[model samples]
Each structure stands twice: as C-alpha cells, then as structure tokens.
Target: MSITEKAHRRSSRSLKALFGVLFATIVLGVTLAGGMSPATAAETPTPAPAPTEESDFTNTYSIGGVLRNGDEVLEGVDITVEGDGFSETATSDEAGEWEVVVPGKAEYTVTLEVSTLPDGVELRNPDAASSVVTADQWLTTSITRSFPMGEDTRETTGFGAQLLQRLVSGLNFGLLIALAAIGITLIFGTTGLNNFAHGEMVTFGAIVAWIFAVLLGVNIFVAMAIALVFGGAFGWVQDALLWKPLRRKGVKLVQAMIVSIGLAIVLRYLYLYFIGGETKAMNVGLSEAVQLGPVRITVASIISMVISVVVLVLVGLFLTRTRIGKATRAVSDNPSLAAASGIDVDRIIRIVWVIAGALAALAGVMLALYRQVSWDMGFQILLLMFAAVTLGGLGSAYGALVGSIVVGLFVELSTLFIPADLKYAAALVVLILVLLVRPQGILGRRERIG
Candidate 1:
C-alpha cells in the first residue's frame, strides 16, 4: 500500500525472476555438457579417451612453410625431414608450402638438398642448409629459411625483439589476473565476506570447459560459455545454501572466514580426486603464432586479452552507471543504512556472488588455455589473486584491476633478472613493498586500524 511496501514487493518479484532465469540457464548448461539434449541424446557420440603424461605421441607432428625466392613464391622444392627412427620426404606444392608430420618428439634434421634447388637460388645460410629441429612437446614449430636473390642472410631474433615478446606475454597474463581479481574485489565489497573458495570457482570453470569441450565434443567457445553460466549458477547456489544461512545465524566474520577455508580445502582435493593430478590440455589444438611488429603471440592469447579488456570495461560501466550498481555501491559503503533506505542488501550480495563466480570462471578458462589445466591450477593462482585484491585495496573493484595488472607484469618481467620459478615470489615481494609505502593499498582508502 505504501511507497516502502511497494518497493519491497517489487524487489522481491525481481529477485524471484532472476533466480528462475538462472536456474533455467544452469539446467541448459548441464544438459549440453552431458550431451543429453533431446535432439542429440539418441545419437550422442562416445568421448575420446583422455591422454596421460605417459601417453605415447600417436598424433602426427607437422611443420611447413611457403618458400619465397625474393618476391616470388618458389614451388617443387624438395623438403626432407629426417629424425631418429623416422624419415619423411615431400615436395613443395604450387604454393611453395611443404609439411611433414613426424610420429613422435625426436631430434629431427630438416635438409634442403642443394641438388633440388633451382639454379641461382642457393641456400643463404650454410648453417641452415642442414638445420636440426627438435620437435619436443610442442604440437608444431615453424621453420623459416632464407633464400634471397642476392647475398642477404637471415639473422636470429635480437634482444630487443625478445624483450618485446616478454612484454606482450606479460600483458596477456596480467589481463587474466585482472579478470579474476575483479570478482574477488566485488564479492568483498558487497558481502564483507572473504571467500577462500573463490579459487576453486576458477578451477571449476576450466574443468567444466574441459569436460564439455574435450569429453562431450561441444565447440570450445560454446563449452566456455556453458562453463561461465555454470560458474554463476554455482555461486548463486553457494550463497543461497551456505553463506545466507550462516549470516542469518549471526556468525562472526572470522568464523565465517574459517568456514570458507574449510570449504576450499574440501573442494580442492575433491577436484584432484575426480580430475586426477595429471595436467589436461584443451581440445583446441596448437595455434600458429601471429607476428605484430617486433612481437609474436598466439591467436588465443590475443583473443583472451581483448575479451578481458571488454568485459572489465563493461563491469566498470555497470558499477558506475546502472541503478542496481549504485545500490550495490551504497550497500558496500554502509549495509545497515542502505537497508534502512530500501536497498535490498541481501539481494545485492547475491548478485555480487553470481558476478564474482562468472568472472573467476572466465579467468580460469583463460589461465588453462595459457597454461595447462590441472587440479592445483586454481590453488597456484590463489595467492596472487589475494595479493592483487590486497594491493589494490580490499574492497575496491578498480583497485583490484590495477593491482592485478601490476602483479601480472611483475611476475612476468621479474623473470628477466631472477629464476623463472621465483617469479611468483617476486610479485609477493612487490606487494609487500607497495604495502609498506601505502598501507591502505594503491587505491584503498586509509581506514581506522584499531
């Protein structure tokens, strides 16, 4: 009847509608992941067996390229690839391209026999005349040979080019960290609950994507979408079933934090038990490198960076410009006051949980693509996510973004001077130094310490 009562009624209706939509989306995701859609259920194909660390390289390895004689593409040139226990020979097609798939990872010698070359098209590098290419774990490697019309020769990549390559890699890594850190900061802002199990949410995304993409034969992009939806659903269920009741029971923040730690432990080992300890690769096979100026990167890494930037910008806009976003900010500032002013604090917290889960899952997917998927993948990055949030400021989303990017770059670029294994430690060291200089964090407001 009154304005206050009407607002409460409207909010309740909206909340119910949100829950219903989320539930439907989750069900559809599960069905797709299971390969049980009504249209495909009857003809669902059996999944291929998973690969193990000791699994033999049954898949063929291939390497080829377009051979150019100055500005003209050369053709009909013999490209011989010979290795221990394997040998293959092929002639270049009309396009001047040649490829060979070796059976396994072995030291291979690729030779361009001088007899088969066209007249006056001599090998530019005598060293590359019989080049050795060791095909290791990588799915493929490119071979670029020089055959200039004149006496110009090929040169190795310079130090400046290598530095630029590392910089691009750092940017890619930093963007992924930013994606996950934003979710952590958002949840902390709205609920004031430190979620230790947040890293598990990241693992959940990768694992689900692996299952759907690799096992169920879903398209990789579709599988990632399903994983994101499932992650959001998992968050909603977690809040509805666990944190909501705990809050209603008046559990102290410290006690709740302890509970989250326990939950995290349970989820981590459960993932190990089911997924096993071996690292899992995505179904998407190797991608060729794309050169940009002085740096070269994979297509996946570039796409991940682009997606991270777009999603983060959208989130920033949502937090600043939308009605619910303003209300969420109000609740984060003062829960009791916001509640008294007709803001549904619990609803806002629930929304935050969903958003946090989705973002973390997306981060996990990107991480898995960059690295490999393993049970402890999320655990490994958990500390970095915390550092990002702490360094950015505990409850500031923008601060988390800034902190994550800095940490990502620090972890990557530090490898230049220190051992690669100590890169993570270097990031932590930076975090400590930043805290000493500005205890409130880079963007964190100074709060009462007592």
Candidate 2:
C-alpha cells in the first residue's frame, strides 16, 4: 500500500478507538453515577447540586401599602415579609402604593419609609383595623395594613380576620420541625453514619428540660441550657463507647448504621420505662395574645423562632471560625485524607457527635415548648429528619439548615390544600422526587462515595 493510504488507515483506527473510549466513559458514568467514591471525584471538580424550592405555597393574597411624603405619594418603597410563616417581598408602584401577594392564611407586615416623616415618626392604631386582602394560603384568609402619611401606626384593612391566626400556627409548627431536622442532617453529613439513636437523643433533651422545669423548678432558659449540656455529654459517651470502637474495628458504614438502629430501640424503651409515655407540657404559663392586625400570636411561639435563628447563626459562625470546627469540616469532607494530613480524626468525630447531640437536645426542648412533650416525640419526627438530611445533601451543614427549612415550609404549606394528616406525606413525596432527579441533594456535590 502507498505510504499516504497506510497513514490514513492508521488515523482512522485512532479515531475509532477514541470514540470507543468516550462511549465507555458515558456508560460507566450512567451505570455507577451515585455509587462512585468521594476520593475519586475530588480529583475533578464536581458540579454544585441543584437548588431546592424554599417554599411550595404560592401567594394567593395581595396587600398594598401607600407611602407618602406630604401630598406626594412615595413610589417604589420596598416591602418585605415580616412575622410568622411569611416569605416574599415587593416594591411600590408610581402611586406610592406597593402591592405584595402572600400565601393565604399567612400573617404579614408591611413597612414603608418616607424621607419627610420627621425625625422619629412612629405609628399606632387603636382599633388595629386590618386591610382587605385576598389569599389562598391554608383556608383562603385575607387581611391588609394601610400606612397613612403622618400616622404613628397603620390600620389593618381588608382582612378576613382568621388569616393571621392560621399563619402563626403554621409558622410555629414549621420552625420547630426545622430545628429538629437540622441536627439530623448535621450528624449524617459528618459521620457517614445514620444515627438512628438520634430520636432518643431528642427525647433525652425534652426529658431533661422537663426535669429542670417541673421537678427542679428552674427557669425555661436555664433548663434548656442544662438539657443541651447533658445531651452533648451523652453523645460524647456514645461515641467513646459504641461508635469509636466499631469504627476502629473497621466496620462498614452500613453496619454502623444498623447498630445505631438497635441502640435507638434500646434508648427509646428506656425512656418509656422512666417517662411513662404520657404527654406533658412545660410548666410555664402563657395566656396573653399579642395581636397585630387580624393575627394573634403568643409570646412563647415568637420566642421559639428567635431562639432557632440565634442557634443556627452561632453554629454557622463556629464552624467557619474555630480551628477545631475547620478540622471537623475537613474530616467530614474526607476522613482518610484528613488523617493522612495528621488531623486527629477520632477527636473530630467525637466533637461532631457532641455538637450534634447538643443541637438535637435544644431542638427537642424548643419543639416541646411549641407543643406538648411525649416519649414518642422524637421517634415520630425521625423519618422527617432523615428526609431533611437527604434532601439538603449528606455532608453539608448549611445544606442541612436549608433542607430543614425547605421541608418545614413544604409540610406546612401543603396543608393548605391537603388534609393536615397528609402534610408530612407531602414532604416524603418531595424527598422521593429529589432522590430520583438529583440524589446528591440541594447542597451536595455529585461525587463518589465510598
């Protein structure tokens, strides 16, 4: 054969081989997508996971606020979501009135700023008349607030009256669940161990809080603190006795998770033996209603939300700022490499367990405050916690927070249409959908897992 023709044939053969290699790679990726080990994927930068929906409840109610400076209406004022179960923001129109749509049965507040309102113009309304609005949020209730120029406070206009009550109730429930779910996600993200005993950890927190509040006659805040400390110690002991030894013995992650299941049952029955399966409330009495517009919210529920936010923020800061926290992040990111780098993997793991336990305890106490406490409280929430962890992505702490919030909102908002009994089922449905479409979760990178 001519030299040119032979060279052409060689080139064609090379091209065919390249195509075959590419085809095989695509096949491998499809077949072993989620099964890949994390170490392998770390060599190549993986795509960020897709964002999850924050809330599924669409706005069905509209509230318009008119801001004015003297005779001129202040146009384009920004209005943000305020109060319970509220999300969404808007800007004013040329007429100085800003209209915002919110989910029905949700409570909201509209605040406007004007340049000419004097140095400290405050507004107050005596009758607290709510504005008229349209809503489709749970039960289709509507209310509104109007801010008149020079008035110290605005009067609510056009509301159906019961809208605020429903919003507050839904929001309180959502926040409590979100708190518990965060702890579940945090542990799962770092340990690679599904701590089934987590439910018991929550129970322990509530029980401790109860003991302080009822038996010992301590303040609620102090009781919560005691519960957190005890919970952390309990977690540390569990790591020292059970998980650390199992890990050192080279047990597989799946095996460790199964062992956790056994521990969960044991702890739960022990709780039953002592606490007696009856529901109990914190001893603090709260009968006062703080009414704004058509909504009436209790002081306790408001306190619960503030505490949840503070805890989330402080934990986030600690993880980002402290050396041990950074080390913990590294270990969670990759334990083998972390150990190779001379980091104390065991210590980090212990710390993670303690923190996780503490958070779980705090969450439990807060939840009991929102509702009533029972031995089965944590067990009832276990599945939802798992859903939040999976939905947010397995090893990302912030992902846990985001996932919990998402799940909480989804559960509460779905009740707008479905029966309250089935709201949690909606969260499960969402979890399944997320797994099918993007198993890596909202904040997880789609990399290999060992």
Candidate 3:
C-alpha cells in the first residue's frame, strides 16, 4: 500500500478507538449520575424545547435520525418512543435513518435498542432516570426534528439499563423458584415416589414462619429457624405415619404418587383453612444494597443465595462422604438390592424425608423473606418445580440443581425482550424445546433415558 493510504487507515483506526472510549465514558456518566442501571440504557428522553405561547393540537410529529457511533451509521436498530401516554416505534433503514410520527405537544423518549451490544461498548439511556420531563415550547405543526445519534457507547452491559433490569428480575424469579424446585428434585432423586405433597410441605413452612413472626413476637431469624425445624418434623411425621407403611405394604410407585397427591390437597386446604388466603410479608426490613460493579444486590437476596449454596454443599458432602449417605444412594439406585445387601433402607427413607422436609422449609422461608408469603405459594411454584426436574432429568440431585439454575436464569432474563407477564411461558417453551432436542436434559445421564 502507498504510504499516504497506510497513514490514512491508521488514523481512522485510532480515531474510531478513541470515539468508542469516549462514548462509553459518556454513557456511564449519564446513567450513574442519574442512578439508573446500565441495563436500562437507550432510555434517553427528548430535550424539551423552550416554552412558547400557544399550544397546538397535533396527533403526530415526524422524527428522523441517523443511528451512528461516531462517523459510522448503525443499521437495523430499533427506535421507540415513550411518555405523553402514547408511543410510536420505528427501525433504522439500510442507510441507518429512521423516522416515526409520534404524538405531539408532550415530550417523548427516543430510544435505540438492539438485542445485543457491540463489544467493549455500553450505553445508558438517560430516560431510565427518575428525572421528569416537561415541554417548554411547542413543535411547529408537522415539524421534523433530527437527532444526531452519537457513536456506540462504551458499556459492560452492552444493551445498557434494560439489561440491568432484566438481570435483577431474572435473579429474583430464579431465587424464588429455586427454593421449592431444589427440594422437589432432591426428594425425587432419593426416593422412587413422586411426592405431590411436597408443595404442602413448602406451604406449611411459610405459614409456620408467619405464625412465629406475627404471634410469637420472635425475631425474624428465630421465627425462620422455628419454621425450618417444624417443617423437618412435619416431613418425618408424614413418612412415619403414611409413606413408610405404604412402602412396607409393597404399594406400587404410582399408588404412592397418587397418595401423595391426595395428601397434598388435604394438607394444602388445611393450611388455607387455618391461615386464610391473605398475603403476609416476612416483616424483616432489608434496606441495603451490596454494589458489585454495575449490579446492585440486596442483603436479603445475598443471604438467600448464600444459604442455598451452603446447604447444597453440605448436602453434597453428606451424600458423598458419610456412610449413611452412601446407604441412601444405594437405596435410591435399587431398593431391593440395597435391602438384600443389609443396608437399612427404611432408615435411609426416613432420613431422606427429614432432609427433603428441611430443604423444603428452607426454600419456603427464603422465598417468604424475599417476597410475600401467600396461602398458595406452593401451588404457584409447582409447575416450575416440574419443569426443573424434567429439565435436569428425573431422579438426579446434581441434575436438579443445574436444571433449576438454568431455568431460573433464563426465565428471569427473558423479561428484557418479553413482557413480564409472559416470562413464565418462555420458561415452559424452553423446557419443551430442551426436552425435544435432548430428552435426557442438559445434565441428565444417557443411561437414565427411556
């Protein structure tokens, strides 16, 4: 290449790099200054014009812009409007110009949204801030405004403030569902019966926790402990009184499952009869955010996550290292063989019940602490639990854990593109697709496949 041509290319590259850095800095400043999360980027409100005398009624005003990052125009970008209680949308053409006829008189937000952000660049939307907007001037009837969209902004969350909202929402949903799904998966792995009553077990824990907090006047932590203990105890009693005898009678696995379903209904309404259908808060105030980079997490959420991790670790150790744990695994693998080999299958079953009950209670208490406790909390999570188990492969604790995390994260993240109301539907759809593609589940063993 000629010297002049090489020099020109080098200068262009350097300028592009500098512009990228500048864009990121500006975006960060704009979002952080406004206390808006980076995920919600592309939320810039229109800079209102200076107020003039008369207000003109116009149904729409034309807006056009070259979506660009520095000197380059970005193609295939989505632009949306908000505020004025009405919205209009448009997409950039091949030349990166977009036009929309938006409702006039009131100011509106113009946002640049795309599914993924360009590498090493993040932009924050100014509109996500709590700042209010008011028009100081009226647009000339049928006036056209052109905004010179700047270079792609530098960012960690490439999509900006919208991504942050999605992360938080997903984390919330995943954490909530994990509480119950984990327990269901654990119990199923250890025992052959599908315990439909597991849902009631969770509800019982929440109601008991509520009782302690409301009537006993105990500290929330203490109340939670009480719930956990009582929940474990309930599981023990159910095994001793119902499941154990049924097993001894050589009842079919399907029969045991049916019995569990009946027990679930009985126990569920009994809880409802006593507690009613009202929603109750945990009443423990969690007021601080633990900032990690661009993401802010609350104390309650951190605590819940920590507790789950610790419990799962302990469960892992108990199952792998302890003698009793070995026996439990043996029974799960083959009950008749384990019994014939002198492993105490009945004792293992009882212990499994206790563990399942404890985990269920813990999930219930954590969920209640993070959100509201309701009479139907268990039922609300039942389908999700089924999805996790099916996704993780039936009868695998490790699979369940892995599956729950996947389901939880995806369902939560879907909120970015999907309406919040339809997030659960996305999860089910993903679950069905996963099943079709890999019937054994993500972590399920090939041997376990039908």
TM-scores of all candidate predictions against the true structure: 0.67, 0.62, 0.63
> By TM-score, who's the top model here?
1
Worst 10 residues of 2 by lDDT: 126-135
Tell me the tens digit of each residue's lDDT in model 2 across 247-267. Answer: 665566886776778678867
Best candidate, lDDT: 1
Off by over 4 Å in 2: 1-171, 448-450
lDDT for each residue of candidate 3 in 153-237, tens digit (9 for 90 to 100): 5555556765775677566656556656656766676677778888778778877877787667777778888888998898898
79-149, model 1: which lDDT tens digit per residue?
88887878888787887778887666677787776677777786666556676776553545344434333
Ranking by lDDT: 1, 2, 3
Better of 2 and 3 by lDDT: 2
- Model 3: residues with Cα > 4 Å off, grouped in runs: 1-158, 168-176, 287-291, 448-450
TM-score of 2: 0.62
RMSD of each: 11.0, 22.1, 24.3
**lDDT values, one for every candidate:** 0.81, 0.72, 0.71
Model 1 CA lDDT for position 441 = 97
